[model samples]
Target: MSSGPTGQPSLVRTGAKAGLAFAGSAIKGGLLGLILGGGVFFFYLGQLKGPGNTAARAGGAGAILALVTSPPLLVAVLLLLFVVVYAMLGVQRGRTKAMQHLVAARGEAVSERLAGAIAGRIEAMPRTHGTLQRAADWLSVDALSKQLAPVLGEGKAVRSVVGFVLNRLPMSDMLAEWQEGRAAHGAPVAAEGAAQDPALRALLTRRINETLQEMSTPSRKPLYIALGAHAVLLGVGLWLVN
Candidate 1:
């Protein structure tokens, strides 16, 4: 919502737009349900009624519709829909929250491992153009683990930090340069620190708020596919009941 004199009007307009959008979405969902329900009944009712019972086919059709659209069945379908939607949408949120927990619980260890793995590699790269990807690779491989094992030791903890660096948060390259008080662009360090003042921890925590904001959100295709699968399963159950 915007502020100032036009705020009230803008808010009203926004609310109206949201209402319309929701209504349109509901209509589409209803239409899709009707179409799927009709298709399922058409395919199954014929086999259920049999050929000699053609006279009662129409009646059986009605009975099937009534059964499938009953309050209990409808409620089940709606609940399943909600579950599928939530599962699809909540995956990213859950993954991010878990990552947050990992960082909080093991920040120091992970940062030290990360710095051990990639810091020397980045610093030894002759300040090339592809310093970033190389830094990521160094963190990814295990061969470099030996380089810093004497100090930081080696363990499964490195995997956790590497995944975060390459996938969730991207600060691998900066840690090395920060330690040396320089950057790939040949810029000298300005202030030379963060709150904790350790290079690895600084790089890990620095811009973390902003980097997390850039985490990729799951797309809608999987959501649609999940909903379709749920609808099919519900159809199968209804068929069994009939």
Candidate 2:
């Protein structure tokens, strides 16, 4: 109901923000690992050379250099790899959440449009005359299923409506099935003549198909953000390893 230019941020902007936050967290984690690893390396080096002779000091220094340049560095690289994996997962989760939010926002609009379209179609039907046509004209979205019951049957009408409204979206099947199940448990049985009307069902399906086609806009901003985030994370990880 609330339509404003600044209602919510766009999906790409949200995803970009999420990516940056994940990158920051991952860099901090990598730095912390490097610090802890370096601390342990230095602690062992100090332990290797106590108050001893110059020969012992020389040997300890050699050992420290060898350890630092080899196994400890390798461990640091491995830690960076772990961080890279963690960052990737975090970014993916963030992107998925952003996509869900975008779809939900769009879906509300689609539902409203679909409801108005269907109600208008129902009222315009030549077969639906007299009081039924008047009722359809005044039907609210909440009462649409009930109004449709006389024409399309109770269970089939709800499923048909839900499927028509949601079938093109990502979670369409899930939502339709949930609505159908909910309706089956509580909706009243349809009039005896309801099942004979295929015209209304066909009309609803056609409208949905048309709406879906209209909704399909080509946008790759999310994919670009995901790729860019991965590249940045990989670069940071490699830099940390070096």
Candidate 3:
């Protein structure tokens, strides 16, 4: 029922929520893997048939087309995809820890600053300790985003970091809003002398904002995925169609 000093359950932590996420991620990962693997298999099948064999030639073309558009490359693609999704979950999970830290840090930040405590808690919290680490990572992103929203508004640097995370950009239009707000208040870094130092917070916020903006634009990712998925399907379709 309670965790030991290690902060983990005496027993395994699996349950309905964990199970569902695992199943979902597994299904997703598997489907993607299958599509990728199948694409490769079909491509090879056609290649083995050689150019002399017209059917095989056409089939190979389909396979190559399929591979071209897919997300995970034929080599190391699965692990890579899993890791990307997993890291997302880690970031999300980190936020839950962030909230707990925030709550604890809130009381402390009033008297002191939370940067160290927040960072420490984040480091100490169990890193998605489960087979479904990837799923956990995915879930954590939402949690972190929600928890950090208010603090982000006040911390320009932190906000910029968030934005950069989202888009890998140094700055973005999102920062404009924060800048305007600061200008309106006439204190670009109000908490500069404070323990938390509002300016530093702003930097982090800015980076995070970048990441958020990038994520908001679903067109780039979904469209790319769609095109890649179809490329494989298209090639296969031709073979079957013929």
Candidate 4:
């Protein structure tokens, strides 16, 4: 939504576009799933129930029906499987694309928030490209954990995030740089030098750990559908055998 001069929020077309994309994908996905699943069923049925014996003149039509049905079943199963696999792949790809958007949005959010927090405390921290890159490499785990937290839950996310943050958040480097050069030339010896500021580092470490402990969780829709499909297939196969 965008704010107008009158202060009322206006609906943007982004939501409409997203909705249409989702709907189209959903229809395509459904068709694919049905075809693939139905094909599997047809093939399995054909294989289990082979063409029955039919003598000339009396049951010729019956025998012909079985043969015709069996091959068609196989074809149906093939079609179904093809559709299902493709649909699933499409959905997964779509999800990844959507996530990229979210990642970009959230990344900006995190950066802006962090900048605000450090605005007054730090001075002339001249944005060196590789500095943050190196910091990110060092902070990979924490960064990943934080990124995953919203989707994966807070408890687990926090612990994972904190662990990485602790290992990556080198207070010594920050403190040493601060105490030695421009920022803190004669401010205070920075408790522990660049090579060893364990205390402040520990605080960040603790937070990551705590966050990991409170991690968020993933959805269970796929799991449930998978279990149901397996159960249905197993039951049907067993019934046919019996």
Provide the TM-score for each candidate, comma-separated.
Answer: 0.36, 0.25, 0.30, 0.31
lDDT of 2 at 125: 43
Please provide, for model 1 over 104-219, each residue's C-alpha lDDT reduced to its tens digit, 9 standing for 90 to 100.
43444445545544544544454545455555554554554455344333444334345445566545445555646655546543331212334544464444434433332324
- Scored against the true structure, residue 99 in model 2 reaches a CA lDDT of 35
| Least well predicted 10-residue stretch by lDDT in candidate 2 | 47-56
For model 3, residues 21-45, the per-residue Cα lDDT tens digits are 4455455545554565455545544
Off by over 4 Å in 2: 8-20, 37-242
Model 4 scores what on Cα lDDT? Answer: 0.41
Clashes of 4: 23
In terms of lDDT, the best-performing candidate is 1
In model 1, what is the error at residue 151, expressed in angstroms? Answer: 9.4
TM-score, cand. 4: 0.31
The runs of at least 3 residues in candidate 3 whose Cα sits more than 4 Å from the true structure, single-residue gaps closed, are 1-28, 31-51, 54-179, 188-242
Sort order, lDDT high to low: 1, 2, 4, 3
Cα error of candidate 4 at position 47, Å? 1.5
lDDT of each: 0.46, 0.43, 0.38, 0.41
